[model samples]
Target: MPTVALHHESIRLHTPLPTAFGEIRERDLLIFELTGADGVTGRGEAAPLTPYDGVPLDVCAEALAVYASILQSYDDDAPGVLMLDACREAADIPVALAAVDLALWDRAGRRAGRPVASLLTDEPLDAVPVNATIGAVDRQSAASAAAAARDAGYSCIKLKVGVGDDAGRVAAVRAAAGPQMLLRLDANGAWDVEQAVRAIEVLSPAGLEFVEEPVHGLQALRAVRERVAARVSMDETAEDMGALIAGGADAVCLKISRCGGIAGLLAQAALVRSGGAEVYVASTFDGPLGIAAGVHVAAALRVQAACGLATLEALDIDVPEALRVRGGMIRVPTGPGLGV
Candidate 1:
């Protein structure tokens, strides 16, 4: 049997990470480690945004404690069996279960001396394109930031809207980014259906790649999608597989922390694809380890759209630089396990 260990830490960001929900200065991260009797170890991370993911930090900690207890009773010699049993036992706590499941996958990959990406798919990509996200700022600042991102070699840029003259902000950024750059707007479900329709109408001239979660609920989303020329992607509304399928979104955003682990992400990706929608891998502004996990999943899935993984620069600190983004693309780590 393997011994399971859980560790908690608070990581500070270089700047306040502001979104439509609120501003975040620090994040609570939970790291789970599973050690085999043979002494090899695997690591995973759980990052929950309270009131956002609807999972509190204390609840995640408690779930980890429960999972630790459940894993102690498992006598399975096969890592796959252990993973299955652990998932079944921790079914109620999906986020907590994700931490454990990710660690198990990492352990399995390490045991086989292959990277997790290779284990997940037959044709994994060597590099994946990533998008730079600009927080909501004043018109002048937004324009400057968008220009800087474009000059920095990022071909795709996602701007945080839904606050203080969103239409003005979008216009400024589009003007700065020019026509060739791929532009996206994430409102984080801040508008009513009427407001969304009006905003989309005003901003559509900017030529957006997609507008994410303009309003809450599937019905509102469908309404806005019908009225707007720009494509709509769902974030908060598509938190689970069922909501994602029901939302009828043009695209679905998958966050590993919110959607369980790699396995959970893959399942939802397949479901969204089956329903004729594109799947995008996104982040919760997690630490390096969690971001690395997302990168591997994006590579294995061969995600064609620009992913939201180029966010480590927003943090003041991160795990030793295990992954790097160049020319708006991230090179997947090829080492054993997560390659971190």
Candidate 2:
């Protein structure tokens, strides 16, 4: 059993965009490499996801460094050894660890000649529904995007909130999307508790499905949830698998980069089901690797809700056909080890 070495890559989106006030040009993906004693190689990628909690590049570089720095002291050939499980649970480090951890799992699945899904979540699901992401744009643009997503077959839609005219913007989208679309909101913890409650109260009438991370951290999250009418979800405050389950969250936005990796995601899925709550595995606007890993988890888990899968389009790539959305749903990959 030779060790698996974790690696990373930095790639620009092949394009750039301004959404909701920020410019995203590139992304950091966690790629894991497993080298067996006989020299066989296997690979998996962690979703280089960004959060409201930390700087994107800094988080990824720090994650890669954990593997690199430890390899200097820990043998490269002996994998999964001599590390405290809770090595760094501060905020975003778990996501970094998750990227490497998932890649290793991908490597293992490939080496075993089994599909990552079968090894973990079974076969491809019929379809994992999609929720279109409406970014930080004005009402007209956001409405156009949401309508486009609906035309693309998406049944649910998510809006990035907490900017100006918070209620007005959400209401515009809801009105344009009509009364049937499953509407979700992510404030990225930008709104204060009072602001969050007011926004949710105003939007709930427009058929808001859920609002994520209206305020920062667990305590504030709890307070908002207690007071607000909207179903409060945990996005930024969820760090580890433990936090994903125990942060007193109603639902968690599971990002592969947050928990550790594919293996770490599996660990979190277990936590989600065990906690008797729902999980919405989202994209950190990551590339294909993290998205694939998340697809596997979404398929395996008892997720009845739509996931944040529409974000994948923001990053350009020819994704696997199995992962492509049709009728607003994407099926999990059934081929061996995240096959392209």
Per-model TM-score versus the true fold: 0.95, 0.83
Model 1, span 1-340: residue lDDT tens: 8798898989788767567888888888899998888777888888887857878999999988888777767653665545646655665666777788778878878888998999998889998889989885789988998898888888999988887778788889989988899999999998999999998888888998999899978888999998888999988888643776774689998988877788889988888898889998988887777888899999999999999999888776744556777888888888888888
Instruction: Give the CA lDDT, 0 to 100, for residue 334 in model 1.
Output: 80
Top model number, TM-score: 1
Identify the leading candidate in terms of lDDT.
Answer: 1
User: For each predicted model, how many residue pairs clash, with residues at least 3 apart or on different chains?
Assistant: 1, 10
Q: Which residue pairs in model 2 clash with each other?
A: 3-77, 20-136, 95-257, 95-258, 97-260, 98-260, 98-261, 99-260, 102-261, 102-262
Error of 2 at 222 (Å): 1.8
Please, what are the lDDT tens digits per residue for candidate 2 over residues 1-340? 5455655666666446444335568776666565556665556565544534354666666665666444335433445424324334323365566655555566566667776777764444645777887765678877787778777877898888866666767878877777788998887877777877777887788787888778877777888888876788887677633566664567888777666666666667677668766787887776676777777777767467898875666666665576677877777766667654
